[model samples]
Target: MKNVTRRSALGMVVAAGGATFLAACGAQPQATSGNASESASGSASASASVSKSVRSDYSGVAVLEGYTSKPSDYQPATRTEPSKNAPVPVKPAVANENSVEGLYQSIAFFGAAMEYYMRTGKTEPLRESALDNSELKSILEPEKGTLGDGMQQGKIWMQDPSVTITMLSAQPERDGDAYNWDIRLTTDTGEFIASKDRVEEASSDDDRKTEVERTLHGVYENGAWKLTGMRTSSSSSSSASASASDS
Candidate 1:
């Protein structure tokens, strides 16, 4: 996986944005709509449907659907933050789920949930959905810990980090013991908003955008598939740049 640090907001824009946002506070999304990028308006606010905006019960694994918000309605608190527009992440029914689509569901939902986790300061969303592994865990600690801590402390919240994760294949390529799928991620580093009225935008200063290509690796553990690694094939953002062979 590309370096997933707080420094490169563009690497996380899909997780950042995949949102419902006012076109003014951030760049407008050009991603095609699908289950991967579906969003509702003002989902974080009191206007969203109860079934759609409810918090996670820490039970099932499902995708976190996104909600839209305008810049004028942005708030310093979690109550009406646009990040709230993204509902809790949940996975699909894992029973007898041993197909490529099942893994796609897991990857998509996990990434979406992480976006919500890093943005909302909620831990359970990522907790219940992620399957742990020593190597992947260590590599993601910086992102998991840094963003997780910041959101929990209310120190930082990505304003419109737009992230889009796409599964490139309907099948997997086996490389010895691992199952790998070619995936691509595109991000827009939205304005970074801090609780004390601090705000910064990484990509806001430039027009250049980059697409990252990564190989999503997994292993069938026990009776289920677990995400084991993300190796970068290509990285566009400086923060995400690293060795091609490194995960």
Candidate 2:
């Protein structure tokens, strides 16, 4: 994983992985219509059924884009932003989740946790999620922790960090206790580097984009879906870069 930090307008610090913005931001979500990359109109915004406009949440963490935000909305803060470098805490679990929704949220949760870890050296959200004792946890938790440590001590951050899931689907396992989900994603991410705070987009060859395809194992429990493990199904590197950048 690549390490870099960015700061949002809200005084929140974000993190991404790799040399280019794409690696920092993990995956892109396929929008229902229009190009997901071009459709987002504002800073730190995303394209999904739920609006990505920045909204105040009691939890301090920015409200997820796919969720409906209204003046009447209220929930306990899932994360705490004590300072620009502190990790943003996340709600431990989703509420009233169905299989499909739970699976989707779980995937989003992974990205969110990574972002929080990148900006701040916190893994509480990851530990709180279903990934806690799973294989994915073992694989990513320490890596996230290491990155967070650098951000916290080095004072580096990422900017304009965003993730999109272009495709998602799921099927029940033979044991009926869990579901296997597939996600196709793209990310536009970058970092703030150097003493002068120079900004660097996660770039490879420039004019190219990268897409990742992975499968996640999930189980719905305690009114929410939890991720247990994951496997990489396939990935597109420079071969699809031209097509990806065209989007």
Candidate 3:
């Protein structure tokens, strides 16, 4: 009788132990699964939040979209003037004769001229240069001419001096078939003003970039340099035109 009682007690204890072990095994799997689900959900939520933040921060400007990097192409070659009151260096007379640098400077100034027009919505007076007369006549004309009519209606701000123009090399050679340029512009004034970046490709292609190069016909008008006409480069046309109109 004593032996049977001991055996029965041992059997009861073993059964209870087995039940506890089974319960622990079941609970562990469920808890682990729940934890993994929560972790994944948290990660997904974080990703969504980041995406929303990026979308919200972007301004609805056309120029900001295509700009992948900052402009660091041209370092200051030389400082012509140290004082603000001093006259800036003028393009050399000998260097101005059908030189690539002359063209580059002309194109750069044309951008500034367009900015000036955008602000006033009237034809700015031309500076004297050796540009083609016919080209000057075309943009100066009031009706169909580009510089005359305001392209868009809005307040526009001029870009700061931080704006840089870089000429890119298409071919490996120094004198390649065609050239490319990237213009970076910035403004930190107020909400009415925003930053912009423009990249223009001036190839022989019939594309808009090419049109910009063709249309940028200039002449040396008065004693100062002036742009007679400009064809908007593909990269900067919309932004430049809009900014000019706004100004």
TM-score of each: 0.56, 0.47, 0.27
Best by TM-score: 1
lDDT of 3 by residue, 1-247 (tens): 0111112211211122100001100000000011111221233322332112222222112111112222234121112211111111222232132333334444443333332332223233123223334444433443321112211121112121111223232111122322233322221111111112211121222221111122233332222223322223233222221111111
Q: Which portions of model 2 miss their true places by more than 4 Å?
A: 1-89, 92-98, 132-148, 152-154, 170-175, 191-210, 221-224, 236-247
Clashes of each: 17, 27, 15
- Model 1, stretches more than 4 Å misplaced? 1-82, 130-132, 135-148, 202-210, 231-233, 236-247
Tell me how candidate 3 scores on lDDT.
Answer: 0.23
lDDT of 2 by residue, 1-247 (tens): 2322222211111111111122221111111222112322223121221212122222212233343221232221122211232334344223114434334545655565544543333555555444535443322433232333334443334442344444343232333666665555444333323212233443442212234555556654444455643333254231222111110
TM-score of 2: 0.47
lDDT for residue 54 in candidate 1, whole number 0-100: 26
lDDT, residue 110, model 3: 36
Better of 1 and 2 by lDDT: 1
User: Which model, 1 or 3, shows the larger TM-score?
Assistant: 1
Per-residue CA lDDT of model 1 for 82-197, tens digit only, reads: 35444444444431134444455556655665455545555554454333444233223333234333455545565554445666654567777666876665544454444344
